[model samples]
Target: SAVISQKPSRDICQRGTSLTIQCQVDSQVTMMFWYRQQPGQSLTLIATANQGSEATYESGFVIDKFPISRPNLTFSTLTVSNMSPEDSSIYLCSVARTRGEGFSTEAFFGQGTRLTVV
Candidate 1:
């Protein structure tokens, strides 16, 4: 299993401001995924990023709002643009790690960055 860490465990921001969170993994991974947990909801996929290529975002998310960057095998960053109170949520980082014979799709999530936009 790989260990993952996230920056800024929690933060409060004003509307129209932005924040960037960083993620780091102990081991090199082929793919890194981003997710969001709203105030009272389950996790939702934001995007998936691999080194040397652009990220693939989910239906509700767009590049202009949630920009992702994976510069290497073990690190990545996500920036939330033009924040608002509605944007407050727990942002998490995930990655696929090998588990059993079949490609293990097991995901490791970061502690999560809690953002409160006011």
Candidate 2:
């Protein structure tokens, strides 16, 4: 099992500003992903960060808007670039635990960074 921690539990930022959130895992993980939860909305996967390759972003999310960096196992960062009021949401970091044969188990999520853009 792995434990995930996120920085800046909550914050308020001005529009057009950007915020970088950090995620740390207690153990090395093979699958690390970033998600976003809009107000009163379900979680949306932003991207999956590969250990040594560029992150694979979801359909709606672009690399320029949500750049991700995974330098190594157990660590990653997600930056919400050029924030807007619509970008206000809870950004969560998730890591999936794997079982035998590379199958994934339940995913663990961090406390999340609640950013409110003004």
Candidate 3:
């Protein structure tokens, strides 16, 4: 199993500020994903990080807003480039885990570090 740890469990930042979150895994993985969850809402995938290549961002997210870096298989970093009240959300780190045959894969969340931008 893969375990992930994140820092700054929660933070309250002023407007027009930025926060950088770090994600570390216990084991080497082919890919790592960054997600954001609004209060009482489903997770939204922000980007995918593959070692040795630039991170691939999903629609609606630009590299300038959420820059990602994957220097190795077990480590990655994401920086919320700009801050706004709308950016307030719970950020989560997840990795896909393989399951038994006929069963779908599952994603593991890192308890989610809540970020509040005022």
Between candidates 1 and 3, the one scoring higher on lDDT is: 1
Please give, for residues 1-118, the per-residue lDDT of candidate 1 as tens digits. Answer: 8899999899999999989999999999989999999988999999998799999989999999999999999999999999989999999999887778897578898999999999
lDDT of each: 0.94, 0.94, 0.88
Query: What is the per-residue lDDT of model 3 for residues 1-118, given as tens digits with 9 covering 90 to 100?
Result: 7789987789999988889988998888888999999888999999998999989999999999999889998888888877999999999988888888967778876767799998
- For model 3 the TM-score comes to 0.93
Candidate number with greatest TM-score: 1
| Number of colliding residue pairs in model 3 | 0
**2 or 3, greater by TM-score:** 2
**What's model 2's TM-score?**
0.94
lDDT of 2 by residue, 65-109 (tens): 999999989899999999999999999999987688868687899
Using all chains and alpha carbons, the TM-scores for the candidates as numbered come to 0.97, 0.94, 0.93
Model 3, residue 38: what's the lDDT? Answer: 89
TM-score of 1: 0.97
For residue 12, model 1's alpha carbon misses the true position, in angstroms, by 0.5
